[model samples]
Target: MTAIDIRDVSLEYGEGSGARLILSDISLTVRSGEFLSVIGPSGCGKTTLLRLIAGLVTPTRGAILCGDRKVDRPSRDRAIVFQDYGRALLPWRKIWSNVALPLEGGNIQGAALRERAIELLKVMRLEAVADHYPDQLSGGMQQRVQIARSLAQEPKIWLMDEPFGALDAITRQQLQDEVARLAAERNMTVVFITHDLEEAIYLGDRVVVLGAHPGRVVEEISVDLPKPRDQLTTREDPRFLAHRHHLFGLLQGH
Candidate 1:
């Protein structure tokens, strides 16, 4: 039940004369146990906002709170899954060990660590590749491995930065469904950044659209669709189409 509150957040690069604002007074709420989809143009500061929430970086003019705690730096309670699977995973380490990396910090070793890693890997459908290295798996599989690693951390919040953008259409859609299911089942608070409108609608409980040029929230739409969203039926639903048309128009204007 961890909710994220971003208050009048703003980020700037450089300083004084050279300072360029990347985000300006961007404020929004991610409800507890809700899947929030953030979509915008190429330079909308979507990733920057995600990084701020992850505490990988700090806001120059505002505060971000996870529940009641301020986010000035990274915490174990938050886990980030980046789009670059090649860099995110260690090719040297086997899949099981990669998934086990976070748990090792807590001195959770031997059978305990193995069991936990396998449980998460199984959840991500990567149990069969436990003995393989990152190089041995496909791009989609590697992403799943990264997700398993994130799950091992047992974070209160899941922050993803266009994680499925690198995969093919079929693979991306498959992983999209997997992610949606995982978020709902575990009740993990998620903030997903993506450029895909359909992907955003399909996965998010609500979608927040950001306008470019010193990125700011322009629109927030609640997806009134039912749960257990099916790929075929959900996309074909009239409501989904309507949301798509309206969001498309909004993005075009931004």
Candidate 2:
């Protein structure tokens, strides 16, 4: 089953003489329940491609389909977890309410909304901080809350834009493991964008490498590693290192 299908997609910014093409004829398919991570040089249109699938941006050409439906604008089936956790969370609302915000004005309310929010918070190990405001939580804790909120929506597809980029090494690794576990448990189809090669390989079923200066797919590598992966064991595997080297060479234009 295809969760996301991008066919001959291209995105251009500016216009006329000032026009700059960011993505050139990019095409990819994300399978249902698959975790895909996109890696590229700094200026590449990795985020642009992600936004296109998220219905946050329109492609200059080609079509983006999500679960057989064309994506022209944002839909409830998709949720984005951005790198800026503080920006994603509401400073005024308590953690529980923030997690439940997506359910407001629908059917869920009062005790039921609170119950779901608290349940998700517990999944994130944030039950103790349910009443805390965004300002009260640390960076890692804040990001966790954002993740819980995103999960609370129970989105079928998750588009993560370097969600753990802002964290320290330990926190990043910790969350990386947690994310992988949670994604598998929820059977989510994820499209993750990251500059970290190891993180990409560790989290993704397949890693797509994009080259900048007119961004395009340079290489696509299948991890083939067993699931329930851990950072130490997976990273230490010889095959993992080889794939990392291949990506490094691709990024170097070799």
Candidate 3:
């Protein structure tokens, strides 16, 4: 089943001569329970495309559909994890409170909400810091908290924008595995945006490469690597290397 459909979409800022065109006539489909990683150069509208799917921004033309519904605004079904974890979290709210914020509006309350928050924190390996504030945690831990909060929503589609960009190498790799595992276990549909080609290939079932200048799809490469991928073995596989070389070439205009 198709989880997302971007049909002949185009986005621009301003109007007439002063208008800046960002995305030009881009179209794509994302399948349910699929891991899709989008990569491109600095100004290739990767984040914008993600925002479009989230219904945080509307296209100048064309429409985006999430499942059978037309996407016009953000919904609980779609959750976004931004690269800047600092801004995403509420400084005054303790870890558990932050995670439970979304559930507060629903039927969940009191002990149940707290329990659910702690549960997601455990999934992110952050249960130990359930009482801590965002200011008390390290960059990586803060990101993990952010992830836990997003997961608490139990979103159908996960939209992540360079979420691991600020973490140390070790932490980045660890979270990459955690995200891949969680997504698979829940059968969640994920739209991951990152500038790192290797990271994209590692996590994605298919990698979508966008071209700059107009920010459109250049190529969509399928990653046939086995699930529950091994960092060492998967990266070393001949097919992995082939896909990497191809993406690098596309980005470099080779």
Candidate 4:
């Protein structure tokens, strides 16, 4: 089943005088329970494409369909996790409250909401800092909380824009593994945007490459590496290295 379908979508920033075309005739489909990563040059409209899917921005042309329905506005069915965790979270609200904010006044409340929030926190291994403020936690911890909050929505589709972009190498690797595990376990469809080739290959079932200067799909590579993957196994796999090198060549326009 197609969870997301973007058909000939194009987006422009402004009209006539200051018009800047971002994406041109972009089309893609994400299958249910598939992990797809988009890798592109800086200004390749990768984030713009994600925004279109999330309904945060509408395309000047073409249409987006989520399942059988067309997406006209933001829905709880899709959740976004951005690179900036601080901006995503509320400073005044504690961790649990931040996670529970989306459920406010919408059926779930009191003990049930609290229980769900704590359960999500536990999944991210953040239960110890449940009552802490955003500022009190490290950068990695804040991002984990943001992940928990995004998951709390029980979204079938996750749109992540470099969710671990700011973390140190070790922390980033840890979270990448966690995200892969969680996405697979939940049977969620994910559209992840990142510039890291290895990370893309590690988490994605297929990697889509976009070219800059009027961004378009340059290539789409299938990752045939086996599942239940660890960083060591992925790194050691000959097929993984072959895909990585192929993607690198594509990125370099080789």
By TM-score, the best candidate is 3
Candidate 3 Cα errors over 4 Å, as ranges: none
Residue range with the least summed lDDT across 10 consecutive positions in model 4: 100-109
For each candidate, give its TM-score against the true structure. Answer: 0.97, 0.98, 0.99, 0.97
Per-residue lDDT tens digits for candidate 4, residues 63-133, read 99999989889999999999899898999999988998887888887989888888889999998888899
Q: Please, what is the whole-model Cα lDDT of each candidate in the order they appear?
A: 0.93, 0.92, 0.95, 0.92
- Of the two candidates 2 and 3, the one with more favorable TM-score, higher being better, is 3
- How much is the lDDT of residue 247 in candidate 4? 89
Instruction: Kindly list the per-residue Cα lDDT of model 1 for residues 117-213, writing each as its tens digit.
Output: 9999999989999999999999999999999899888888999999999999999999999998988888899999999999999998999999988
* C-alpha lDDT (0 to 100) for residue 209 of candidate 3: 98
Question: How many angstroms is residue 168 displaced in model 4 relative to the true structure, after the best TM-score fit?
Answer: 0.8
Question: How does candidate 4 score on lDDT?
Answer: 0.92
Candidate with more favorable, higher TM-score: 1 or 2: 2
Show where candidate 4 strays beyond 4 Å: none
RMSD list, candidates in order: 1.2, 0.9, 0.7, 1.0
Alpha-carbon lDDT of model 1: 0.93
